[model samples]
Target: MYRYTEFDKSFVKSRAAQFRDQLERWQDGRLSEDAFRPLRLQNGWYVQRHAPMLRVAVPYGELSSAQLRVLARIARDYDDPDPDVYRVASAAQGKLGTERLPTHCAHFTTRTNVQFNWIPLEKSADVMDLLATVDMHGIQTSGNCIRNISCDERAGVAPDEVADPRPFAEIMRQWTTLHPEFAFLPRKFKIAITGASEDRAATAWHDVGLQLVRNETGELGFRVSAGGGMGRTPVIATLMREFLPWQHIMNYIEAIVRVYNRYGRRDNKYKARIKILVKAEGQRYIDDVDEEFRQIVEHDGAPHLITPAELERVRASFVPPALHASHASHASVDEAEANANGHPLFARWLQRNVAQHKDPALRIVTLSFKRLLQSPGDATADQLDIVADLADRFSAGEARVTHTQNVVLPWVRASELLALWQAAREAGFASANVQLLTDMIACPGGDFCALANARSLPVAQAITERYQDLDELDDIGEIDLHISGCINSCGHHHSGHIGVLGVDKDGREWYQITLGGSDGSATSGAPQPGKVIGPSFSAAEVPDAIEAILTTYRDAREHDERFIDTVRRVGLTPFKTSANAVRVNEEVSA
Candidate 1:
């Protein structure tokens, strides 16, 4: 984990204080809501459907135990909505045929940020104060500025990693934070970086995707792609640069964003993403960027070109933490395997929730937040504290938020696997279904988000309840089932094997199912959007339709084939036929 220097600490505290003053003026009627909206958004505060939501940037998904504890404290102390506000929100949600919304909880977003949906605007300053104490804030988390830079959760520890991307991600964070040049662009821009061979970070689906690669001379550089995004129109980014020297990444990205800032659309927010511009301009856009780069270097002297010394300064902060000396005396690999074999539940957890690490003695263990009744990616105040404690005890005082909306103890020792599993199981976070169907990704839908056309929680809950059997889930195998309440794609539904998108139809909630989406992982192949099977189904029929599709795959899949592979090989016809049958049956029953 990157430690915040005194300068970084002071910068965050000053920003928080500045936001406090802005909030005070807004509260006293000196500033209009229209005027204060941008001010609040720049600080990571948003007036959502029923409450003021706060999104705290967890840069590159890294979190210290102390930071996690502060987050837990915020959830416990400041996330409660006013009684009247809760009552009205609950009533409105009930009318939509969904359960009352949960408060005093933090949701781990697909972008690896932390969100609180029910915090009051009055306490915003105090919350900011608390976040600053931990060197965390909502800066650039909600505005149309450069949002938080995300990276592979396993960046430093993955076995196949070529280089640790955190150093570069940190450098980008420093360069982009409050960048006056790119702030308030045509739309919110996202960037993802991964150093691993497997595309664990889903870089291809980002506004700017960067893969750390080596050129012919084995010199470190970046494979840059731009324009990928998901919304009303999903697009895979076009390859802009095959190999850009690592030192010039900041300079290159500046040219890319600068071109977009100058030429990207602004009139319609719907069509303002860089993906739209890239799609419309195609090769012309690349040519423009190349020309811009040339001008920036030759004319502007490439001021942002990173120096080797500056790179080393940032990289120094990411030095791997020393493992406990006791690890040398811990149980051997054979003994750990024997222990896992003895406990079937532990064995299952080790297989599903744990991943290989660069160090054989260390394992990356996922603490599953997806469980019965609880919303996926949501952690209660108590659960957050438990995770903090677990991280301190098992993972060298650090944990990471994964892109799939789960928590990862990246430094967990192999010997502590059983103990950590026991503690997590006691805390309702040891489901051992990391990428299973039950482990779905969902956003705060109409129940909480004002932009949602339908509720995603109900559909997620329904599917979770339907697939509660661990044996059945394991048998079904790894499947990405992502649900989004709207076309915004907050839940990354466009990349799921079975994607469910909520839609509005005649003032009622409906769902559109898609098949064969991938996030460009080693397992999921290339990054691409799923295809809709047919017309939308009522929210009530979504679960049954999903079941029908999964059943189709199980019946026809070849031996040991994953759901995605099976979908690819057999095509969407069988799944589509079964899902459509469910829709017809529901209509007839109704």
Candidate 2:
């Protein structure tokens, strides 16, 4: 994990204090809502459907136990909504036929940021103060700015890693944090970097995607892509540079974003994403960025080029933590294997939740946040604290928040896997469904987000409840089932093997289902949006529709083929027919 330096500590404290001042001014009427909106947004505070929501950045998904403890504290103390606000919000949800909305919980997003809803705007300053103490903040997490820089959760520890991307991601993070020139772009921008052979970070779905690569001569560089995004337009980023020297990454990215800032659409929010610009311009857009890069290097002297010493300094912070000399040795792998063979449930958990680590002695364990009862990605304050404790005890006092909206104990000793699994099971998150159908990605739809056309939680819950049998989930195999509240694609519905998108029809909630989407992982071929099966279906029909689709998949799939593979092989027609067959409302199609 990257530890904060004195300078880093000071800078975050200063920013937090700055936000407190702005908040006080807004509260005292010195700044009107119109004037204060941008300021608060820059600090990652947003007025959502019911109360203020705070998005706290966890850069590259890395967190120390202390930082996790602070987040837990925020969820516990400051996340309580005002009484009247809660009453109104609860009543609104009741009308939607949802169970009572959960509060005092933090949501782990697909981008690896932690979000807290129901926090009063007035207490935002207090929350900021608390975050600052742990060298955390929500800076640049919102508004039309360079949002958080995400990286692969297994950056340094993945067996297939070419080079760790964290140092470069950190370098970019520092450069983009408060860059005055690029602060207010036409739309929000996101960047994802991965150094591993497997595309674990979904780089191709970001505004700027970086893959660490080496040339034929073995010189380190990057494969750079730009314009990928999801929303009204789902685009796989265009490959801009096949091999950009690693040292020049920042300079090259500066040019790319500069080009976007110059010509990206500003009049219409729907078309403001760089993807729209890139799609419209194509070769011309690439040419513009090339020209900009030339000017930046020749005329402006490439001021952002990363130096070797600076790279080393940044890399030093990311070095794997050493095992303490006094720590007791854990059980051997042979013993764990023996235990697993005896306990079928333990074997199931191991198969789904544990991943290979670069170090054979260690393992990467994902704590399943997707289960029945709770909305996906949500962890109560108590749950958060339990995760923190687990991280400290099993993962060298560190953890990583995965892009799949789960927590990774990236340093768990292989021998201690059984004990850790048991602890997590007792904590209620060890469901052994890491990539199964029940381990779905879903947003807090109409339940929390004001932008939602329908509720996502109910749909997710219904499906989870329908598939409680472990044997059934394993039979379905690994799949990406993503649900988004609206076209915002917060839950990344566009990339799911089976995508359920909430839609508005008059005043009622309907869902548009898509099939054969991929997030560009080794298993999921390439980054591409799913195809819409047909007209939207009513919310009541979504679960049955899904059941029908799965049934169709089971019928059509080749031996041992995954759901996504089967969808690709036979195409969406069969699944589409199956899903639509269950739809009772013909009016939805009309």
- Any idea what lDDT model 1 has? 0.90
Q: Which stretches of candidate 2 lie over 4 Å from their true place?
A: 82-94, 324-331, 584-590
Error of 1 at 534 (Å): 0.7
Off by over 4 Å in 1: 90-99, 324-331
> What clash count does candidate 1 reach?
0
TM-score of each: 0.98, 0.97
Position 355, candidate 2: lDDT? 88
Q: What is the C-alpha lDDT of each candidate?
A: 0.90, 0.90
Worst 10-residue lDDT window for candidate 2 reads 324-333
Expressed as tens digits, the lDDT of each residue in 1-590 for candidate 2 is: 78888999999999989989999999999999999999999889998887888999989999898988899899889887565665676576553432456767899999999999978888899999999999999999998999999999998989999999999999899889899977989999999999998899999999999999999999999999999999998999999999999989999999999999999999998999999999999999999999999999999999998999999999998887787222433446667778899889899988989988877778889999997889899989999999999999999999889988899998888888889988999999789998899989999888778899888988999999999998998898899999999999998999999999999888788899999889999778888999999988877788889999999999998899999899988888888888878874444565
Q: Model 2 Cα displacement at 174 (Å)? A: 0.6
**Residue 521 displacement (Å), model 2:** 1.0
